[model samples]
Target: MNPKVRNLSTEVLSDNWYILRKVTFEWQKKNGEWQKQSREAYDRGNGATILLYNNTSKTVILTRQFRIPTYVNGNESGMLIEACAGLLDKDNPEDCIKRETEEETGYHINQVHKVFEAYMSPGSVTEILYFFVAEYTKDQKVTEGGGVTDEEDIDVLELDFSKAMKMAQNGEIKDGKTIMLLQYAQINQLIKYN
Candidate 1:
């Protein structure tokens, strides 16, 4: 319903893994001229991510996994340290994140605070990610979480809050969502750093 756009058309390019489509449309520029444009967008559905922090222990939970995309893009190991996250496959954002957290981190947390929502990549990917934060305790560790699926080989790590921040600063943690949540924790004083 954008007044500046019209004659929109989309053609599916690939549907093997997820949906990818070529979108063509006419957009009216500020000069009142209509310009035709086309762009390919990958639709992987929306997802949610959470940062699990322990204020008492001054620690946070993270996961390490091998990502094929990063491996192809110059990451030598292809292994990435990131927060627990998953796509919202027919569930609400809150429920999806909770399930992902338990499956990926082994912490069955009941309370979560939604921090924000953002589009991780807008130009080529159409995924709006929901961000969240939750407090964790030692008793919450119910399992040795390494992901439930065969395709997901994840390593869960518990590190000091300051060390986690340093990892993000030094590029050890390259995941955008994980960095953002760490920054959010620092900005909001979620954990005290000595």
Candidate 2:
């Protein structure tokens, strides 16, 4: 059955580096009754995020940074391990992912294997994140990779596949996106398991 949409309205909630918009809509029930609901959302476009791995070296490139939300939410250190990701601004997913990988890790990937597109938080936010995996080598040079001043203070972390998997299992790596990427890599045999 098709969903009957009605009374749709959108309101701007916040506009910064990313804009948040609140959307409301109504639907008709099977009995022909109208039901209304609202959701607050933000869209940074369908951005691309990458899980970069050096298969030869068995290393996965990640970033560690203090997250304000995490800190406020009772995390002692608030440092989060995450895959390199950024919002897509007038660029395609492939280009965005490549650029983000370079900006965050300074690795220029020759080939990026598409993993899957996922919604970070569909119930509230409208962020559709594209996940990818790229192979790199140790010869690749890395630049200082923190975001701009307003969002700075990121530290690049390189970990072996085994260690990364262990960290995830032990709850040291708690970021959803990063967890998803690691699981994808493991399930697809992109990262060798002991």
Candidate 3:
């Protein structure tokens, strides 16, 4: 809710997987003038992402997958390396990350610490991503996580935390969520850089 703006009308442009709406509104200017405008917004439900780290091993788990949007935009391979993440459908953020971690990476992990949450793309997409961090040991791996059959093709990668950070810094890991989490890990001292 904003005091300087009044929402007028909205029209649904697409509502298949997620809702996309075009909204018309009036905003009061600083000089006391009213301006009318229209903007399209995407309303995908919020999601959660987690960084799985092994303090003893000094490594972290990440995933690689094909992202159509990235390919369409400019990426030649259309593949991206990202942290374990999923939409918060019926479960809370914590539970969603736990499920996603196992489903996408095959690690059955508990005891996650919520780091922070953010709106990934505020200008258009209305997706608030909840960020989390959890410690993982080799024994907790219960399945060969590569995503569900015919659903997601994910390549699970366990890399040295230092290498992961360098990849993020050098554009090898281009996913924003993954980059953010890796930086957070360093700033918060989740893992020491070599």
RMSD of each: 0.8, 2.2, 1.3
**Cα lDDT over the full model 3:** 0.94
> In order, what lDDT does every prediction score?
0.97, 0.84, 0.94
Best by lDDT: 1
User: What does candidate 3's lDDT look like per residue over 1-194, in tens digits?
Assistant: 78888868999999998999999999999999999999999998999999999988999999999999999999999999999999999899999999999999999997999988999999999889999999999999999899986968999999999999899988999999999999998988887545
lDDT of 1 by residue, 43-131 (tens): 99999999999999999999999999999999999999999999999999999999999999999999999999999999999999999
In terms of TM-score, how similar is model 3 to the real structure? 0.96
lDDT of 2 at 167: 98
Cα deviation of 175, candidate 1, in Å: 0.6
lDDT value for candidate 2? 0.84
Clashing pairs in 2: none
Model 2 collision count: 0
Candidate 3: segments with Cα more than 4 A from true spot: none
- Ranking of candidates on TM-score, top first: 1, 3, 2
Per-residue lDDT tens digits of candidate 2, residues 1-194?
44699778899988886778888999898899999988888776677888888777788999888888899998998889999888888888888888787777777776788878988888876778988998878666566666655766778889998899999999999999999999988888886655
Q: Cα RMSD (Å) between model 2 and the true structure?
A: 2.2
**Candidate 1 colliding pairs:** none
TM-scores for every predicted model: 0.98, 0.89, 0.96
User: Cα lDDT for residue 114, model 2?
Assistant: 82
